[model samples]
Target chain A: MIIDGLINGIALGCIYALVALGFVLIYKATHVINFAQGEIMMFCSYICYAGSTTFHFNFILSFFFAVIAGFLLGALLERLFIRPLIGYPILPVVIATIGIAMVLQSVAALIWTFEPQKLDPFSGSPYQLWKVSISPVHLWTIIITFILIFLFSLFFRHSLVGIKLRAIAEDLIGSMASGIPVRRMYNFTWGLAGAIGAVAGILVAPVIFIHPHMGSIGLRALPAAVLGSFGSIPGAVVGGIVLGVSETIAGLYLPKEIKDVFPWLLLFLVLLIRPEGIFYTYEQKKV
Target chain B: MKKIKVLAIVGLCVACFLSFTSNTIADTGVNKKVILVGGSLDLTGPAAFMGQGVKRGINLYFNKVNAEGGIHGRKLKYIAEDDGYVVAKTVSNYKKLTLKSRVFCLLGSTGSVGPKALKPYLEEDKIPLVGPYGYTSAMFRPFHTYLFNIYATCEDQAKIFVDYLKTELKLENPVIGLLAEDNEIGQDTIRGAEAQVKKVGWQAPVVELYKRSAIDFSSQVLRLKAKNVDALFFPVISSHSAQILKECQKANFQPLLFATATATDLRFLKMAGDSAYFGKGLRSFATQINHRDNSSGAEEFRAAIAKYDPSNKDPNSFNLFGYGIAKILCEGLQQAGADLTREKLISALEKMDGYETGIFAPMTYGPNNRQGTDSVRILRADHNKKDFVIETGWLHPE
Candidate 1:
């Protein structure tokens, strides 16, 4: 039972990691934490659901179509809402993202009524691994997370556009001085983050079922990103895993009420000791 | 001088129109021929189904009554404002429904917390609000003069589940376990379970609390399996119910699963799909009759909804609840008689005894007892039909 709980927690954490990647990517490129990342995830999943159900597209085909739709959505949102506040402070941009969140939330509600409906492009059957049951959705979530992580790691290391996105993250003005298309990179990062959110949403829909407020899963992602030191990508995965594992352990050993609070308590204690987070990278200045 | 004379003539005509209509339009919503009622429903929130369904039920009953020439020559109009299931919005909706609509009474709203928030205001104004979705015990426990209840509360539903297990299942010592959500309804259900468990001389049951937003229930299922409980009672939303069903199947933890009225819908089965096969042995406690039961009352409800509320021909728990409450309100009006007043209506409601609402158990009320009924019918999950089948008649707990 304990082992089963541990496995389940890791699968749950992988979902958080996927969502945290969206937050981390957006913050990395534009230095603005999009409050609407969760809603973006929810809306994209709805698009995926609509494509498969309404347009009669195959399940996997609709997923890829939704990913592209999500990319374009992120790019469009950046061009329309976020781009205007480029020269402005972070607070205004964050506020603008919140406004977009509200708009997106209502749009989803208007499109799909408030009633929660099932989305099962993925089945709920689990495979038995050494007497431990693992649901297919959870397995897919973990597999997709690892693949995206490996791909993102390579992109950041070797890809030219990835390097430009990183340069923009480091300092927008300096990147532009070096003739890097900083604005274009910011828009590109938003689209990339949006695509990441779509994957997370698609994986999550089978488990939670899709609703307008399902984007609230992003609430946990915000903390995951914060616990991962806000700047480091790998930190997000580690932080999410720790949060998930501890919650399951608490549910198994401690009182049930303690399970929900256990992750936040751990995050609190960690912040108290290491304000810079577990995987902090301090930047050195050149004179 | 000519323009001034014309303006004076127009002003006098307006004043005379107001004076002529003033007698019929009083401060109270009741006029010579119309009785206005209002509701602050969660039309667009997580519980929107409840609000929307109940509204249909209310309208169905009212439409039938209106077609038959209304209660005591007064036409009934129910105006509902969408609160989106938010408490603050429910409060604001309460204000708009009360002040702007000038409703004679307030009818069905969703969620306990929203009604609880509006309780103080309803009390201050001494306004009567009737037949809210039975989620709170606070309404009738203290016997608030203004709030009239028709069906069993969440606590009653929980106790009924336990009582059914003891009496029908013949468990000499029922080892009931609970999977409670971390919300007010969850706590209320736990309290009722504890009461029933103690009554039957059972040991303190194992309790598991899950978060409201928790989509995954594998850990909870693993915990339930570890306990090896005789029965697992979980009162949660439809999706949560469906998710728990799927997870329990995956884990192969087949305890006698019990759910509250919230899970009494095809929505759960539709969401659970093939996974709902695990719930073949499931039992549920609900206040009203299932639409598929095809009882006389259910038939009448279906016919009425089809005739009146054509859009919602298919009835669910929410619509059933509305129909029950609307019938009760109409009775109160009839009992109040030709000289209708709020106080008289309250007196009439208090005097209600064994009043059958056609869809639910007979309700009895008193001056001190505001609760209408503490009874429910048991239903068994039928996977083949993909719906709940009525297994027993109404059972009332002490």
Candidate 2:
């Protein structure tokens, strides 16, 4: 039972981690929280559904279609909503993201009509690893998430665009003085986050089913980002895994009524001890 | 000359009194030309499918009746406000409908919580709420005089499930398990199942409760598997039920799964996919006949949809329910006679006995009975045909 729980938790954690990575990416590069990350994921899932079911595209084509659409959507939203509020207070920027979330959710609902849709699972059946049963979709989610994390790590460390974005994150005014295209970098960062969200959405849709309000899953992933110190990419992954595994384990052993709240409970305990989180070190900003 | 003047003045005063008394007896929503009905529906939220289906169904029946010259030379006008499944919004909409729109009565409002919240308002205002779409026993248990329930309570369905397991399946001593949402509906299901178990002198079944927003059911399924129960009663909505079925398939736990009428839809088959096609599939208790069935009521409903709502190429169970309930309300309206008032409508509905709407079982209501039906038929999903087939005749709670 414990092993099965662990495997299930890890698979579930992969989805949360992928979504949390979107949050971390945006926050790191732009210092703005993307509250609509879940809605982006939901909308992209619908795009994938439209591609596969409506246009009769194959799996690979549908996947690329959704990811590319998500990139453009992210870039467009930043250009329109966020860029206008660039010199405003941080609160207004956060509120604008929230407004964007509502509009995206309402638009998706109008287009899809609140009907939950099905996506074909990645594979036919579950594989039996001794006593633990793992579905192919879940296996693919774990594999794909890890691969994306690796690629992202390499890009941030080695690529010039990634370095430029990180430099903007460190000192926005300094990067502007150095003649870096900060606005374009911000746009690219949001696009990258959106593409990652699309991947997360398509993978999780088969497991959870697709709906306009599936973006509520974003609320769950927010805690994951917070637990990972809000801006650390690797911390997001570790925090998501810890939260998921502990939640499943608690559900297994504890009372059934407390299962949903166990994640928040664990987060509270962790925050009480190490406010900086497990993977990230927090430095107090001297304002 | 003075005597003639006094007689004329007295006759005019008597005529004036008669005119004022005649206007006082007429109701607020019913005028000489039309009868206005209103509803607060979840037309844009999670339960939008249900709200929209019920709305469309009600409109189909209303249009049919209106084209037939309406009841007693008055047209039926239905106005629905979107509550988005929120209880507070439902209350506000109820106020708006009653105070501003001044609808004659409410028909087919969606969600258990919304109707439950509107009970106080219904009672205080002395307005009738006909054919509310919910399964919570609270709609009828204490018998709110103004609230008329059209469907069987979830408790009634649960009892019928237990009875089926004992008699038809012959699982007299089999271990039973229940996985239900943690709400009034879930509580009612537990109460009914436990009541039946006690009556049959069988051991108590295992119970698991989950929130409505919960996405995963791994632990619940695992616990049920560990218990090795023979049959599981899960009276949840269709989408969540599909998720549970997937979890069961992944765990390789194949128990006889029973659900409520809400799962007897094509969407369940779509969401569950092959898991629904495997083994015996899912058996559920249904209040209305399936739309795909060849019964006279179903055929009539389909034909009506084709004619009245041509855009609705595929109508589901919720639409059928809405159509059936609208029929019942129309029946009540007809029975209330031309002198319609809120009290008259209530009396008319209470007088209904063995009134067959063709889509539903024989509905019987009395002074104390607000629940329209107490019987339900069992249905099994056939994924190949993408529809549900009747498994049993009308089964009643034992």
Candidate 3:
């Protein structure tokens, strides 16, 4: 039972980490939280479903199509909604993102009609290893998440665009003055976040099935992002894994009523001790 | 001549007084041209599928009725307000419908919490709510005269499940378990199953509760498997039921599964895939006849949906429920006659005895009995056909 819970928790955590990566990416680059991250994921999953079922594309082709569509959607949103309010207060931008979330959800419902649709998993059935049984989908989720993390790490370390994004995160005004094409970078960052969300959505869709409200799972990942420190990329992954493992282990021991709230409770306790999250370092800024 | 003139004036005043009193006695929502029926439903939330299905079904029936010149020369005008499954929003929609729109009665409001929240106001205002789509025991308990429930309560369904296991499956000493949502609906089912177990002189079943938002059921399945539970009763919604089935398949644990009428749909089968048809398969208790049933009512429903709502390509169990409940409400309206009022509607509904709509089990109601039926039909998924097949005739809890 313990082994099963651990495997399940790790798999669940990978999904959370994947979603949290999207949140961290947008926040790190633009310094504006994209509240619609989950909605983008949900909409993209529907697109993938449509691509496979409606358009008669194979699963791999549908997956890539949805991801590309997600990229275009994110870039379009940044250009149309985010860019217009460049000098505005963060509250309005956040509210605008929330509004965008609502619009996306409603549009998805209009298209898909709110009926839960099934997506064929990449692999069929679970493989048993000793006493523990793990789903192929979960195995794929872990592998893909690790690969994404590695790719993202290399990009940030070496790529010029990644360096410019980091510069913008550190000093937005300075980067803007240093010939960083700030608006285009912001669009690209959003597009990247959308692509990551698309991958997360398609991966998780097989497990949870596809629905308009499936994006609410993104809200669950928010705690993971907070736990890892909202701005740190590696922190999101660690935070998600910690949250998932602890939640499952707690379910094994704690009262069933507290299971849903366990993750939030763990986040609360961590925040109480270290307000800057597990990976966040306090930086002395000159006012 | 003066006396004659005075007598004529007195006669005119008396006739005018009678006319004023007659107009005052007329019902609020009933008019010469139409009868306004209203509903507060979750048209744009997590349960939007249910809300939309119920709405479409009701509209399908109403459109058919209206096309046939309506009941007693008054057309049925349905005005549905989206509550989004929120209690406060349901109450607000109720107020808008009754106070503002002045609907004669509420027909097919979805969800248990919303209808439960409206109980007090329903009684206080002396308004009739006919055929609300919920399975909670509270819908009929304490016998709210204004609220009419159309299906067997979750508790009754649970009892029926236990009975089926003992009588049909012949599992005399089988270890039983329950996986339910941690809410009133879950508690109600638990109460029924436990009571039935005690009645049958069996060991108390292992019980596990989960949150509604929970997608993963690995821990619950593992715990149940650890207990060696041979049969499991899950009274959760369709999506959760499918997820649990998948989890069980992953863990290589195949227990005889029992679910509520909510899971007796094609969608559940699709979601669960091969896991659903594994082992003894999922035996679900259904309140309404399956849409694919060859019964006359089922045929009529399919034809009506095709004629009235061609846009709705896939009609499921919820839609069938909505259509069944609408039939009952319309029956009550027909029985109430042209001089319609809330009280008359209530009186008409209470008098219904073994009224068979062909879609639902024969329903009987009395002044004290608001539950339309306590009987449920068992359904099992046919893997080959990819649809539900009716396993048993309507079985009563007792």
Candidate 4:
């Protein structure tokens, strides 16, 4: 029973982790909490649906194009909406993001006309392990999520572009004084965040049915981001797994009525104890 | 401000006079032109699919009736608005339809939560609300005279399935378990299933509830596995149904799965991959017209939608539901015979008994029986089941 719980926890955790990673990516770069990250991810999945189902593109090709589409959408949103409000009061920026989310949702509704779409980009079906079973979709989510995380780490650590983004994130004025193009980096951050959201959306779609409302799963992953220290990349991963597994196990063994509160309970406990997150350094901001 | 108010009053009077004149002209030709049925829909929310489908169903039926010279020289006019599936918006939209649009009756208003919110207003206004998309006894309790429930209650529907498994399919000593959402709708199913189990000479079945947005049900399935249930009833929506089915298949718990009408979607089948079609459930109503059917009514609905808005082709079940209820409203209006007022039309509907209109079952309504479509038929499907097969003839709940 314990082993089964762990396996289920890890598998479910990975998806939440993927969502958290997207959240962390944007927050680290922009200090802007994108309330619409999940919707952006959900929109990407719909784009994938349009690519393969409506446009009849090849699966891999559709996925590649979806990533590109996510990047472009993110970059454009940053340039047009997020850039002008760079130094504005936080409320308007937050509200602007919310408006952007609404516009995107309305556009999706107009295009799709509110019907659930089934997407299976993978070729094979679910394969069984001893006493436990796993789907190719879930397995793909784990593998792809890890690969993306690894690639993101390598890019940030080794690439010149990555250094520029880090410089901007750490000190926007200092990065500007150092001749780094801060405006371009902001657009890049949005694009990267969009890409991450898209991948998360594609992974989530096959597991559950795809619809405009499936964006709530991304919002649920917000706790995953918060519980893992909002700014820490690795923290997001660990936090998501813990929350996912705990919730699933609680849904079974715990009082069934309170199972929905699993994520919140775990989040509260984590916050009370290790306020910076399970993995992050607790740096007190000197006001 | 004074000048604006005077101008506004004059403008209002002029608009009213023009409308009155045109309506008089229409009256001179045919008298009662058409009874307009309108609805406030949650076309962009969690229940958007249902809202969209119900509306499509109503439009399809209305088009057919309008083509046949309508009922008593009156064509059925349907107007719909997106309520965002929110209660505030639904209530506001209801007011707009009644006060501004002046619709005759509400044809198949959608949503359990939205309708629940609008319940008091609907009753107070005495607007005949026909065939709301979703069913709960709470909808029927305190019995609003203006409203007629077109679908069977979840309890009645669940009983139909349980009775079939016991009497017809003859599954012996069936150890059943219920998997439902943790919401009121899910709770309603659990209640219905428990009632059915007790009534059917069986012990109460194992019941488990999950949140509406849960991504997994493996743990719940595993617990039922320990119980070795003979069959499991998953009274859930399409998305949850897909998740539960995939998890059940993974767990190798091959119990006969039973689901509610909400699980009846092509999307559910597609998401379940190869094992999509392996289940039996009850649907409140089926489209009397489909892509295959060549009914003239279906053609007319298609044409109307094509003429107005050609883009939305894949009409959801709610659309057909709307179509069916509109037909019933037209039936009531036609039966009212002339002197068309709300009271006359309602009285005409009240006197109805076992009235079949091709699409829906024979409905009987009096002061006592405001509920419509009490007749439900058991439907079965296997892995390769092309369409849901009607296992038993239509049976009315006692």
Tens digits of per-residue lDDT, candidate 3, A207-263, equal: 888999888888999999999999999999998899788878788778877788899
User: Candidate 4: where are CA atoms >4 Å away?
Assistant: A1-5, A123-125, A282-287, B1-31, B265-267, B278-316, B396-398
Strongest candidate by DockQ: 2
* Count of clashing residue pairs in every prediction: 0, 0, 0, 18
Show where candidate 3 strays beyond 4 Å: A282-287, B1-27, B310-312
What TM-score does chain A of model 4 get?
0.94
Instruction: Give model 1's DockQ, 2 decimals.
Output: 0.62
For model 2, the stretches where C-alpha displacement exceeds 4 angstroms are A282-287, B1-27
The interface RMSD for candidate 4 is: 2.2
Superposed Cα RMSD, model 4: 5.2
> Could you give the CAPRI-style class of model 1?
medium
Q: How many angstroms is residue A61 displaced in model 4 relative to the true structure, after the best TM-score fit?
A: 0.8
Q: List-wise, what DockQ does each model earn?
A: 0.62, 0.67, 0.62, 0.48
The residue-by-residue lDDT of candidate 3 on B1-398, one tens digit each, is: 99999999999999999776644413478776688899998898878999988888888888989988898988888899999888899999999999888888998877888888999999999998888888888887877988888888889988988898899989887888899988988899889989999999999989999988887788788888889999998988888888888888777788898888878887788788888887668888888898888999999999998998898888877788778888899999999999888888889999999999998889899989999898899888888888888899999997
lDDT of 2 by residue, A28-81 (tens): 988899999999999999999999999999989999999999999999999999
Candidate 2 or 3, higher TM-score? 2
State the TM-score of the second chain for every model: 0.92, 0.92, 0.92, 0.83
Please report how far candidate 2 places residue A104 from its true position, in Å: 0.3
Docking class of 3: medium
